[model samples]
Target: MPSPEPKLIAGNANRQLAQAIGRRMSMHRGMQIGLVDARVERFNDQEIFVEVYENVRGEDMFIVQSTSNPANDNLMELLIIADALRRSSAARITAVIPYFGYARQDRRTKARTPISSKLVANMMVSAGIERVLTMDLHAAQIQGFFDIPVDNLYASPVFALDILHNFKGAMDEVAIVSPDVGGVARARELAQRISAPLSIVDKRREKAGEVSEMTVIGEVTGKKVIIVDDICDTAGTLCKAAEVLMDAGATEVHAYITHGVLSGPACDRITKSKLKSLVITDSIQPTAEVKACENIRIVPIAPMLTQAILNIWNGTSVSSLFDTATLEPIYEPLYPGLAFE
Candidate 1:
């Protein structure tokens, strides 16, 4: 017998991105790809509830959600949805998270602090998710927190294509920069793709949400610097790094970040910063303030995500979607019993 049709479900967190992904799937497959009818809402006392009206028994289910702002609420919604699907007897469930929340707290920094990312992973596994598909995780090692198969996609392919089109004929004068030492790998990949030089921002962080000092490691003199990172939460690091690069004689600075969790005064800071433009993917839905920012531009990742979903459905290797040399998929299971190999 043939396999059941793939079903795409969206939560309240990022309906726009989910719809875009559906549209891309439809365009590519020449068929209408509709989201399963579901209701995810809260009661008067802020109690979350979820209901899946359509039949999904024995179907390959993909739940599209991004645990962004109001992270706790959205996270609960996803878990509830997964539980509902599992109870409904879905063949397989994949949590398609474009932006995984609590990813920054992947490790225990303070002696008594919690590794919240691991807890979140455990919660998902307990909630009945069999597999995970996410993009641009804050920390790559967070995959180990899950016992199930995890496919961490990269946005470098999308960013590289955009850079080529936007900076055509001027690639020689461009330089890819990592905002801090931690992001050197991400920056270097983009640099290699564009055949440009690479630079690093060596910084000292005195406390959370603040950078005490930053030093540029390489030459940005007379170059159009492009800073690449995974997330832009408060915009503090990007803005400060841009200033430092400019002070060191860089002609212009732009940032290509995957997740734009532009909370607090991020938009304001970007407006007042020395950066020419902030390019972010539509992994997390942009707020009105972010959409209205004159210096910010959004590139849709719906097409890339749609392709990944299709690969998963077809039982093909999703890693082949990206350049293997630059963006390798983490297939080795970090936990013993959950190995995909």
Candidate 2:
């Protein structure tokens, strides 16, 4: 007996990446993928409408959507799509979120703040997402929020491979700096892989969209500092930390963040900052602003993700799919810089 073909479907969050994944799976004939627009629009009242164009009856479906900017809309799109698929009798629906939003709001900082990350996870499960496949979440513990089998793939291998390629000998003098104490585990893992020293950016994020006070916790003097974090939203934290690293005598500063959710003024800050190069993964499609920065480079995870997807479909262990590869980051044309007064 043969197995039924699994379906690959993508929402409007990131079609380019989805297409690349589909292209990789094209080798397997008889496998069909459905791409629905799944974009909701607002009328007068801030109401949302969702439509699923394709039929998913009794089919194994993967909904590819990255909850990036306009995070709420993209998240609703994914949930509604999952609901539609479930109601239509899809055998199993998997929400493949490359960039999960509301992740930073995982814990309650104050007495009454909501754990929105857990809310998002619960919503997906309620919407009929039987499983989840996502990349480096802002908080690793967010995996526990999911009741379904969640595969949290590491972008470290991808980032580590690229760092070794371009940075080359700099790895010997490298100081992997975690932008905050919370990210020490991830930073230390990368540092170990590259045989580099680990450092910490002991800082306090006083409030959202605000500058943080950064203190270099390790010896970064005269070393090439490589900052690692899961996401870079405003670039405020990273840019400020870069300055602190330089002041601490770091010869050069570079960053390898998994998701470049580079929102307002982030590109400008990166372009004018002290960092030599900023490496980001294509987990979320870089916004126009981010793409324009001269120092920003994108490393494709299509191949990495393709392998993971295939492994999932084949009932194989997804752990080894994150094996280190020898690939360099891809440098695309920079966006035109607008000078500030």
Q: Using TM-score as the measure, which candidate wins?
A: 1
Global CA lDDT computed for model 1: 0.88
Deviation (Å) of 309 in candidate 2:
1.2
Q: How would you encode candidate 2's per-residue C-alpha lDDT over 1-341 as one tens digit per residue? A: 11366677777788889887786666544455435445545658866666666666777788888998789878988888888889878888888888989988989989989999999999999999999999988888899998889999989977776676666645578889999888999999888878889989898768866655777888999898999998888798899999999999999999999999888888989999998999998888777767777899998777677777777878998887555532221111121221111
How do all models score by TM-score? 0.93, 0.88
List of clashing residue pairs for candidate 2: 292-335
Report the lDDT tens digits of candidate 1 across residue range 1-341. 22355789999889999998888788767888889998898899999998899888889999999999889999999999999999999999999999999999998888999999999999999999999999989999999999999999989977877776677778889999998888998889878877889999999979876789999999999999999999998998889999999999999999999999999999999999999999999899999999999999998878678878989999998887576232222211211132111
Show where candidate 1 strays beyond 4 Å.
1-3, 324-341
| Backbone N/Cα/C clashes per model | 0, 1
Error of model 1, residue 212, in angstroms: 1.9
Alpha-carbon lDDT, every model: 0.88, 0.80
